[model samples]
Target chain A: MAEEIEISISPTGQVTVRTIGIKGPKCVQAAEAVAKIIGQIESRELTSEYYEAEGHVSGQIEVRGRR
Target chain B: MSSVILVTPLIIANWSVISAAVLGACGAMGFTVASGAVSGSGRARSGSSVTRAEIEVENSEVLAGGGGTDEEMVVEKDGVRATFSRDARGALKVCMEGTGYSKGQLKQIGQELMEQVTQQYVYHRVVTELKERGMPIVHEEVEADRTVKIRVRNW
Candidate 1:
């Protein structure tokens, strides 16, 4: 399965990132790459899956707004 | 199968009234401007009466589109306003109205700010992707929106 990542650039020049794919520190890198494309860095937060997504399932990562 | 993800921009500003930030922010960015006393965008609409602003954005240089018309949207937040639009080639655009600030200068400032914000945004987003999958940040690179994309080469 192909993983997907959605990136958004805010009016304030803020970036919001969300993704669907295999998880872990790897996911962080994915999100970071997008942030850099648009502008600067401010802050970040990891959802619950960031910690639970340990080990893969069916070659895809699940996202649920909340950690 | 090909998958898609929805990313929502998290906005934080001197929002004593909610969308005040949206207007000023959009103005700062070249994509759009603020018109009234308030501004906002992205979120859904409401049946409330308050100051309203409109944002207009388009593929100005036809970088990906063929001289297509710019798209526009209106968002109302805390007596403020906001808007969003996109070009044909997926080149996204945004607008903010209501700031009583510099007319065209806001857009220029926003363009500069977005350059840095986009990088940080990509970094944090990619990190979130990895953690969700229980994987690790094997490698990554984040630049500006048009110049580069977050390429997360996972393991």
Candidate 2:
């Protein structure tokens, strides 16, 4: 999936950076540059998607017949 | 559903950095850098307050370290003039002065310029950081409201 970052600045000069299609710690890493640039990270909230495991999960089966 | 980060920008930029941002914003907004040496011998006077708005950017190092030389700059577009100077507190301030626009209009312009400066600053900062981290930029654009949006991908 392609990652998307949306930065919105209000007329009053407030900036909000939202990251979509990325998960886990990577999202924070992606947005940190903006936070560092702007000033400080006022508040950060993680959605349920963030807690989900990263990447795809594949199953592997091991079969043993008479060893 | 990925993640959302709300940032309240506290400008801690230096005079040099601010000047760069200001110049970029002025260029983008079609404003020309006017000489700060504009004499006070103008012919007419406007009833409206010349100081439309002011933004203070603090530099803590200047206070702790040795005293630094003051910085001042001026730019204008049409009758709108923006003056950037170092205040008594050693913080940089941008004051909007002019008569062509009303108080509300001047405030709007000042705020917009401030936002542009900030957005450009962040764009440069983030792009540099991404490049340093070896992240490839997928796309970048300045939105209608002058907000800079940059998309970088990790391979």
Candidate 3:
């Protein structure tokens, strides 16, 4: 899947960048790339997808039973 | 989504870029560039009766040692006039003057113009840098509130 970067700039000059289809450290890199282009990062939040391994598909369930 | 980041824009560019942003802001606010040659001292005329208000663009720096003119950009709308210039420390400064408007009104206008300038600066920087990075912008739009949104896909 192709990685996508979405950037939103408010009228007041506040910028928000979101990275999709990318996981792990690479996601941080993606955000950093945008920050480098724009300005200093005020805050950042890493979602569950960030904890997943790169190239891992989301929404997978792991079942554990007393078998 | 993987990560979301909030950024505070810092304007650090050459005169060309900064001037472009200033012009864009002026156009958006219904102000016309009056002259490219004007005093940048940020001082009101000695004998003039016009009220003046000056505001600085926050977190901004005009990169020094450029080839552009030292003369400031002067823009006007109605009876009010504004001057866009760089300070000694290379920071962007705006001065608004008008006879009828109160000082508070001039400051408000200066603030609004600065906001628009910042918006235009960030928009140009993002688009230029993304294209340089080989990211193709698949979508772009400006909302009714003047907010800009851009999407780039990295294949």
Candidate 4:
């Protein structure tokens, strides 16, 4: 999948980013990649897509009921 | 006994940071660092007072959350709930909401909301960065969209 990552810097200096094509923890990897490009973070807000595309960590999988 | 000073970094950054930062309709202004910022615009006929808040991210790896030795966890907030995550591109994303009241014109209201959200937005970002570095947290204060007061000792 060709993911789209968008970053916006407002006139006042606020930065906003939108990533399409990924979700969940993988999206975190995306964020880590981007921040590495830009710099550091002061604050941010993300969308559900981030979680979805990021996918879940295998370590978090839990077995219920029997065993 | 190791005093509070013991936990904090002994050396500070080279740049002088702002003691208090206010994120207006635009982004944040203060501190030597600037990342994850944006501006907001309003229509011609909206009005209302503004409410602000700050979001903090604990347990972050300096490089994983965003970038630099000081990384921030990206997040976005709706009217009440805020979503957090890192983008594939490495940008900290945040979405937030403002008060529902109509206190001024559309433009004014929009500006107020933008400021309120961005302040909290910036708050979360900065907190993430500090935590990633394993720096001791001194103190933090949230004041809606108007401003946020943070005091931390340097390493």
True contacts kept of each: 0.07, 0.70, 0.94, 0.00
- iRMS, all models: 8.2, 2.6, 1.1, 15.1
DockQ of each: 0.06, 0.47, 0.72, 0.01
Question: Which portions of model 4 show Cα errors greater than 4 Å?
Answer: A1-67, B1-104, B142-146
- RMSD of every candidate to native, in Å, equals 16.8, 6.3, 3.6, 19.7
2 or 4, greater by DockQ: 2
Segments in model 3 whose C-alpha atoms lie over 4 Å from true places: A57-67, B37-48
Docking class of 2: acceptable
Candidate 2 wrongly placed segments (more than 4 Å): A2-12, A59-67, B36-53, B57-69, B100-102
Question: What overall lDDT, based on C-alpha atoms, would model 2 receive against the true structure?
Answer: 0.67
Candidate 3 structure quality by residue, lDDT tens digits, A15-65: 999988887888888878887788889999999879888765559789999
Select the stronger candidate by lDDT from 1 and 4: 1
| Cα-based TM-score, every candidate | 0.29, 0.72, 0.88, 0.27
lDDT of all predictions, in order shown? 0.41, 0.67, 0.85, 0.35
The CAPRI quality class of candidate 3 comes to medium
lDDT of 2 by residue, A9-57 (tens): 6544567777778788888776776566666777787887678777988
What lDDT score goes with residue B131 in model 4? 66
Residue-level lDDT of model 4, residues B1-155, one tens digit each, is 01110011111111111111222222332212233422222211223444433332222111332223232222222332122222234332222334553323323433443344444444455466656765454655543543344544333
Q: Against the hidden true structure, what lDDT does model 3 obtain? A: 0.85
Sliding window of 10 residues with minimal summed lDDT for model 1 chain A: A6-15
Could you give candidate 4's per-residue lDDT for residues A1-67 as a string of tens digits?
Answer: 4443434333223444344455555554544444443345544455566446333446566778985
